[model samples]
Target chain A: MADPIDFWFDFSSPYGYMMAERIDTLAAKHGREVKWRPFLLGAVFKHTGGQPLPSQPMKGPYSKHDLARSARFLGLPFTMPEAFPVSTHQACRVFYWLESRNPRLAHEFAIGVFHAYFVDGRDISQMDVLEGVAGKLDIAPEAVAGATADDAVKAHLREVCEVAIASGVFGSPFVVIDGEPFWGVDRLPQIERWLEQGGF
Target chain B: MADPIDFWFDFSSPYGYMMAERIDTLAAKHGREVKWRPFLLGAVFKHTGGQPLPSQPMKGPYSKHDLARSARFLGLPFTMPEAFPVSTHQACRVFYWLESRNPRLAHEFAIGVFHAYFVDGRDISQMDVLEGVAGKLDIAPEAVAGATADDAVKAHLREVCEVAIASGVFGSPFVVIDGEPFWGVDRLPQIERWLEQGGF
Candidate 1:
């Protein structure tokens, strides 16, 4: 019908995690193809004249309450993984690998990272945690880790991060289809329906 | 057992309309009393370093897409009202009157305004349109026009707008309970759960 849908995501976001869990099913229901693109969330924010959401001092109780209620309503758990605001380089690299090998696995990897944080309350920014999530997904844990230093993959992740910025991607868990961008996990179904309409 | 909740809101929001549609029911489910507070959303945004969600520019497509999905999910007929933005002074005063007089009707009036704009595509920013909305509610067509300029009510409206700024309320459809603020309509349930748990 139209071009495929691109989902730009990062490992350090709870809303991204929540959207990853449901987007695939919704996409399939609408007979649309989804491409998962993982990038560094922090860098994108820095480039886009925005700051890390948690960086806002006035937004503590308000953010927590909004997210907690959202989690309950969406039937997802809520927790700020101890390693939140953690480094996302390795995760983004692994995501790049998954995108090349199997996009479905990339989706699973994103979900694993989300569960590792909000559900298990683990330090996902840690190397061991990333390895564990990769292992569970049957990806070559060592190979994924080894590839982190590869100039090619590193450069690839770098390009995607830049591309995410240029695309007007203000936040993570972003969906772009037909030149339209939808942000927030709550907007997942809307993307799917738009995909279903195929440019109506 | 904590203090009763102070519910902050501006009438010119669809999400607030959605929240008002069910907030009281949710409150009753939790046996919590809501102290309805009327505030100016324009002022809240001005003081909070925030912009109307659509004004963010980056949030354009996301806003349209998300609202479409939310409408479908909620099974409510919604349209992006032609009048993108409107001031909430008159609406807020009527709300203040209803807040002090008949809360149930106040809620109806709020929902009516939101529905008029979001569902029927009416320009609520226009006084005549507001008059129509008020007349439809049997609120005395003049009440709508009269409240905006009434010295006492306008002053009260100003007081609440100032309070909203002081509280760091930067968004419309803002929900605050017991001095704790929840921004966005999505957080309504958490307020309910908090109240249910003997919370403020």
Candidate 2:
């Protein structure tokens, strides 16, 4: 079997949420597996001189429109959260903790967090909200709460972000297949083509 | 007849060159005409806080790879020019001047300029180089030189860039169709779908 495609994303990125919704299915179609790894975009942005899309000038409004348009184009449910572009470190920490135990359940937790923030318009920065999402997945709320604040989990995510940065991952929904990095959800078609043709 | 598709581009942008090579044909397939307007991205960058893709951190290398990949994907010949991201004011001025009398030849001149820069890896910042490109299109080298430096032509390009900015074009290869804006060469598929469905 080939190496699993590494799907890197920041929980705070709307585009990341969108990609998370479909990457697994797309990878499965090509008989490939995907590894979902969430990291902090804030740390990457600092080193890259990058700003969130919604924080840029003309790009701010266009991105808002495009996000909705893209979701519609992909036939996915989407709604901008009241508190958008939130700090996602808490959720990231929980995700890493869960992933260490059950990778499949961890993916479900990711979906729950994305749905809560993007579909339900809930603020995901709150630890309670993240714990609630974890509870829904049968991972005890206390277990999630405790794990999120654990030094090991926090350090794990920090190391992941550092590794991603060193690998030239400067954006969310960045996919690395056999070391070739493809960034942005818009590059999905190209990624599909790449997988189909085996690097064309 | 429907309004023509407005294609806004910068001469220095590699992606813009890639789009310039195909937009006319794409528009023709949709029974739509295209208005090619070459403007300075520098002005828009100032307002949008955008640096050239090649000047940004991780984006720089990714953009170079994407540019070549996109060209290959589109079946177009491409090469990175040694003197890339050149000041294109002179070429843009000549474009407007030639467009006034003959739009068809102006487009031909545009093709020549893109070919000289991207395909041949030539420096297009110099007046003599632009003159050479124009001369190949039957435009006199002396006349091309004279028009590029003409006060009226200079003002026209300045106004064009302003109009592009006012229209919310913050990037190269920005396409506007029926009041809807699409940025980036990667958006060609979306643009085609938009044209086919008459707006999504």
Candidate 1 is graded, for docking, as acceptable
lDDT of 2 at A32: 96
lDDT (Cα, tens digit) per residue for candidate 2, span A85-162? 899999998888988888888889999999999999889999888988888888888898888789999999899999
For model 1, how does the per-residue alpha-carbon lDDT over B1-200 read when each residue is reduced to its tens digit? 54555667666666766666666677666666666676777776666566666775556656676667666655678788766767767777777766667877876777777778888888877778777777777888766666777788778888988877777676666666666567766565556666666443
User: lDDT value for candidate 2?
Assistant: 0.89
Q: All candidates' lDDT scores? A: 0.72, 0.89
- Report residue A109 deviation for candidate 1 (angstroms): 4.8
Candidate 1: give the clashing pairs.
Answer: none
TM-scores, all candidates, are: 0.75, 0.98
Please tell me how candidate 2 rates in CAPRI terms. Answer: medium
> lDDT at A63 for candidate 1?
69
- Clash pairs, candidate 2, are none
